[model samples]
Target: MDKIVSFCKRRGFVYQSSEIYGGIRSSYDYGPLGVELKKNIKDEWWRRLVHMRDDVVGVDSAIIQHPRVWEASGHTATFNDMLVESRTSGRRYRADHLIEEATEIDAEGLSAEEMTKVIREDERIKDPVDGGRDFTEARPFNLMFETYTGPVKGPENLAFLRPETAQGIFTNFKNVLDTSRVKVPFGIAQQGKSFRNEITPGNFIFRTREFEQMEMEFFVEPGTDEEWHETWIQERWDWYTGLGMDPENLRVYEHPPEKLSHYSKRTVDIEYDFPFAGWSELEGVANRTDYDLSRHAEFSGQKLEYIDQGTGNRFVPYVIEPAAGADRVALAFIVDAYREEELEGESDDSRVVLKLHPRIAPVKAAVFPLTKKEPVSTKARELYNDLRGDYSIFYDETGAIGRRYRRQDEIGTPFCVTVDFDTLEDDQVTIRDRDTMQQERVPISEVRERLQRLISTGSAAAER
Candidate 1:
């Protein structure tokens, strides 16, 4: 965990938010490379779920909506976490998390009083900050961030920052149906920011107060909800592994019937193995048996019903949602790609490599000039410009070729293109692959075509 954190800071992947103010508690800001990597992940998701599929379309709704939306969605009353403050340091934590750390027991189902009693009785429990024995009673803390709608600061004008993108899709269901040519068995996808007032937003960006979500709600016939739910679970699983995630490190956890969410008929989480948490959710696919649309219809006094022209049947559509956190997905990819391997025939010598698939790599390739001399630098810059129009290319001329390659490897650039003296005579450059360490000399004009095919959808380079 320390190694990953250090690498992230050293490589401009992420930084603590508000660093000048001695750094904000659990908030983080993505750097240049981090932003590019994050964008690529989102682009791929959009490509797979929206653009490539004919049945799914996307929508972007406001981050702040009518307060009645929450009332309809049940977020106001149920979106909460168990909060307990430590008497020693006066720091707050999620009681369930605190309980797990102290006794290795799952405390999510416990009542507030039950959790408080356990905290008081356990001698092993001490404030992690100051190691004091005193503590406060557990209580429910609403996760929504409340704000005033306008100049009015009264209860009637209070509004909330959306806690999930799923509600936005539900609220806009009729608007999309009326505007678009979409019909039943179609989907509405969205990607946007969501906020939660987390009690313990630790483990880096794995948990945070502000985060982005890529969520899709697929509307289908009520009777077919379970089948579609399983179908989406399989598809989401393939999505991660298809992009080079190790299947062994990913699993599907089916939610027990007794513990399912209020709106969920069935829920299955796609868990990824993290070094810190062992295994945690990467995404979730849920069968939401028409609860959302039904609630919205009842509250809004509008019919969010779908009339099937083929069967001439009028009814509300069931929903199957596949929701994921962008931050968590990026972390999972980074952790899975990190590797430290010893160099061949060398003792106490090793190299760090981020073997990110080309599709998700921050930099697609690095262009290098053999030396700072005129001809080499001139040719390399031209090639860099050509590729930059199509891909993210890095141009570096100040370091030794081997050292530059190592740098690109560390940041997960898939290939390195070098312009040497031979290039002036043969019109060819040497291309090195990051993972295999194999070099291929190809004509200058062919680099673009080769890389395009290599990184194209479902291509070999993308899968690797």
Candidate 2:
């Protein structure tokens, strides 16, 4: 876990937020390469969930909605964690987490009083900041971030930063139905920022106060919801595996009846073998039995039901939601791609590489000049200019060719193009594959087409 975190910082993937001011705990800023990688992940999600499928449509909802939206979604009342503050360090933590970390107990459904009692009785349950057992009684702490709109600070002006993007899709359900030609079995997909006042946000970007989510709510007939739920579960699993994630490191965990959320009739989480936290939830697919629309309709005095034009039957559609954290998925990909390989003949000589999927790699390919001299550098820059418009291409002339390749490998660039003296005569440049370490000489004019094919196929030697 520490190795992954260090690599992320060293390779310009992520940086602590407000680092110049001593940084903020659990807050991080995506650097240049990080932003590109994240954008690629989101783009691939959008491509598969919205563009590739005809049943799913995309929506961009606001981060801040009306206060009543939370009330209607039951988030204002139920979206809370059991919090306890330490008397010695004055630090706060989730009571359930504190207890579970100290003992071999499943603290999923424990009440505030139960958690408080466990903390008071257990000697191992000490504050993380300071080794003190003194703590306040556990209480429910709402995770929503409350704010005031306009210039007033009253109940009427109260608003909340959305804790999940799913609610926005629900609130705009009627609007989408009226505006688009989508039918009953269609889906509404959204990707946006969400905020939560997390008491124990840690494990780098695995859990954070502010993060992005890629959520899709598929509306279907009530009777067919169970089947659709399983369908989506398999769909999500296939998505991860299809993108090169090892199937052995992924599993599906079904929520027991007692552990189910209020709105979820049946839920299954897609768990990943994270380096820090083993088999943690990377995404959840839930069968929401029309609870969201029913609640919204009851609260807003509006009918959120769908009427089948062919059968003339009116009923509220059940929802199957696939919710995934964008940051968590990116982190999983990074962790899965990390590798340290020893050189063939050189003892104690090694190189670290990220074998990311070509589509998800931050830079598709890098352009390198053999030397900082005139003709080679000019040729490399020209090739770089030509490819930059189509892909995220890197141009580096400050380092040795071997060092340049290592730099691109560390940052997960799938291919590297080198312009050498031979290129001045043969009009061909050497393209090296990061994973296989195999080189191919292709005409300079064919570089873009070759990269396009390799990236699209996610193969090092697709044409070969």
Candidate 3:
């Protein structure tokens, strides 16, 4: 995790937000390469979830919504984390997290009283700072970030930065149904920013106050909800593994009945083996049993039900929600792709490479000139410009060719195209594969086509 974090900052993938002002805690700004990689991941998700499916449609909702929307969705009253403060350091921490860190126990669903009892009884649970055992009683801290609307600061004008994108989709369900051809068993997909006032937001981008979510609410008839839930679980699992995630490092964790959310009849998490936290949720697929629509219908006095045209049956559609943190998944990809390999001939030398899937790699290919000479530099620049329209191409002519290749490797550029003196006569350039370090000569015109094929095929053939 440390290595990946350092690599991200060093290679212009990510940087701490407000670094010039001593940085904000847990806040990050995606740099040049980071933005590209993150966008590729979101694009791939949208491609599969919305563009490829007849049953799914997309929506972009505002970050702020009517306060009553959250109230209707149960987030206002129920969305909270148990917080306990250390008397010694005056620092606040999530009580469940404190218990988890102390005993390696899954304490998430435990009540504040129960967590307090555990903390009091366990002598090993000391303050993370100063090592003092004195602490405050556990209490619920609402995760929503509250703000005012329209220059008003009164209670009636209060609004919240949405804690999740699922509510946005829920509130727009009727609108989507009326506007689109979608019916029951179809999904409303959304990808957007969500905010939560996390008590202890850490673990890099895994848990942050602000994050982006790729969420889908698949509404189906009551009787069919279970089967759809299972289907989405499998679909989400395949997505991670299909994108080159190791199956061994991934697992499905079922939420016990007692731990289920208020809206969830059943919930299962797709957890990735994070280097820092072991197996943790990369995404969640939940069976929301008509709770959302029913609540919204009752609260807003709107009809949020599906009418079966053939049978004349009217019922609230059960929702199958698959919610994922975009930032978390991006971090997982970076962690999974990181590699440090010893050079074959030089035992003392090694190369750090990111074996990212070509389709999601920040730079698809880099164009390099063998030297600063006229013809080579000009040819490389021309090739770089030609491919820029089709892909994210990098042009580097600063250092030795080997050093240049190493720079590209560090940032997960899949291929490096080198224009040398031979290109002046042969009209061919050398293409080097990041992983194999193997080179092949191809006509300048064929370079684009070759990259297209490689990117389409991916670094290695991954089953989709």
Candidate 4:
């Protein structure tokens, strides 16, 4: 974890928000490298889910909605976490989290009374902050952020910021259907920001107050839901693997009957092994049935039915939802790819490298000149400019040739192109592979094609 944090900061991957003014807790700002990496991840998701598929369309929905929406969704009454206030130190904590941290046990589905009893009656618990002896009674804390529409600041204009992106898709289902002329067995994919007032929003960007979600609601015919649900589960599973996430570090956990959401008939979470948090959810693929559309239709008094063209059947469509936190997935990529290897015959020359797959690496390849002299630097910059339009290219002329290779290697640049004096006579450049450190001399005319093939197929066979 420390290695990742230090590498991210040193390489300008991510930074603390408002650091000059003592920084905001649990809030993060993406640096240059981080922004590019995040954009690649998001673009890959859109390409695979929405662009590549004929059945999935996309929509952008508003961030705020009417208060009644929450009521119909059961969030007003049930979407809450148990919390407790420390009597001695006057600090508040999520009751379940405190219990779990102190006793090293999970209290996920426990009721408020159960959490309170566990905190107060359990004698093995102790506070890490002040060495406090006991805990206060537990209470429920609602996480919605309330705001007003008009200037009056009254309940009449009261609305809430969305806690998840799926609700927006539900509210806009009819709009999409009417415009796109899509039938049942289709989907609406979305990528947007959502907010939650979390009590303990630590662990970097894992559980932030404001974050982005990439989600899809695959609406299907009623009786076909179970099959489509399983199909989408496997499809999404394959999508992650295609993006180069290690299969060994990823697993699916089926939600138990008691652990499922109120509307979810079935649920499975894709968990990733992070350095600090072990196995935590990176995405949730659930069979949400028709719960979202039904609730919204009942509350808003709108007909959200899809009529079958062939059978003339009119009914609501069941939804198979795949929800992923963008930040969590990005952080997982960094954690999974980070590596520090000891160099041969040297104690202090150990190397740090990120073995990121080329598809999502921030810089696809770096171009370096063996010498910083007049013609070498000029020629290298020209090549850098040419490749910059097609790919993210790194140009370094200030360091030794070997040092430049190490710098590019640390950030997982797949290949490094070194311009040497031989290029002046032969019209060719030497390419060094990051993983193997093998150098090959290739003509300048073929370099672009070789890079394109390698970046596309991720194969050293391109060099053949």
Residue pairs in candidate 4 whose N, alpha carbon or C atoms collide under 3 angstroms? none
Number of clashes in model 3?
Answer: 0
Stretches off by above 4 angstroms in model 2 are: 345-348, 461-464
* Pairs in steric clash, model 3: none
Worst 10 residues of 4 by lDDT: 455-464
- The TM-score values for the models, in the order shown, are 0.96, 0.97, 0.96, 0.95
lDDT of each: 0.90, 0.92, 0.91, 0.85
**Deviation from native of the Cα of residue 204 in model 2, angstroms:** 0.9
lDDT tens digits by residue: candidate 3, 235-334: 9999888777889999999999988888889999999999899999999999999999999999999999899888999999999999999999999999
Alpha carbon lDDT of residue 314, candidate 4? Answer: 95
Across 1-464, the per-residue lDDT of candidate 1 in tens digits comes to: 78888899899999989998899887999998999999999999999999999999999999999999999998988888889998778899888888899797778788999999999998888888988878889999999999988888999889999999999999989999999999889999999999999888889989999999999999998898888888999999999998889999999999999879999999999999998999899999999999999999999999999999898999999999999999999999999999998888633367789988889899988999999898889999999988996878899998678788888989998888999999999999998888877788999999998777766643334435
The TM-score obtained by model 3 is 0.96
CA lDDT of 324 in candidate 2? 97
The predicted structure with the larger lDDT, 1 or 2, is: 2
Better of 1 and 4 by TM-score: 1
Residue 150, model 3: lDDT of 86
TM-score of 1: 0.96
lDDT of 2 by residue, 1-464 (tens): 78888899988999999999999999999999999999999999999999999999989999989788889899999999999999999999899889988899888999999998899998999988889999999999999999989998998899999999998999899999999999989999999999999998999999999999999999999899998998999999998888888899999998999999999999999999986899899999999899999999998999999999999999999999999999999999999999999878633377888988899999999999999998989999999998988878889988668888888888999999999999999999999999888999999999999889999887766545
- lDDT at 352, model 4: 76
Clashing residue pair totals per candidate (backbone < 3 A):
0, 0, 0, 0
Indicate the residue-level lDDT of 230 in model 2: 87
Deviation (Å) of 263 in candidate 1: 0.8
How do the residues 406-429 of candidate 4 rate in per-residue lDDT, one tens digit apiece? Answer: 788788787898888888889899
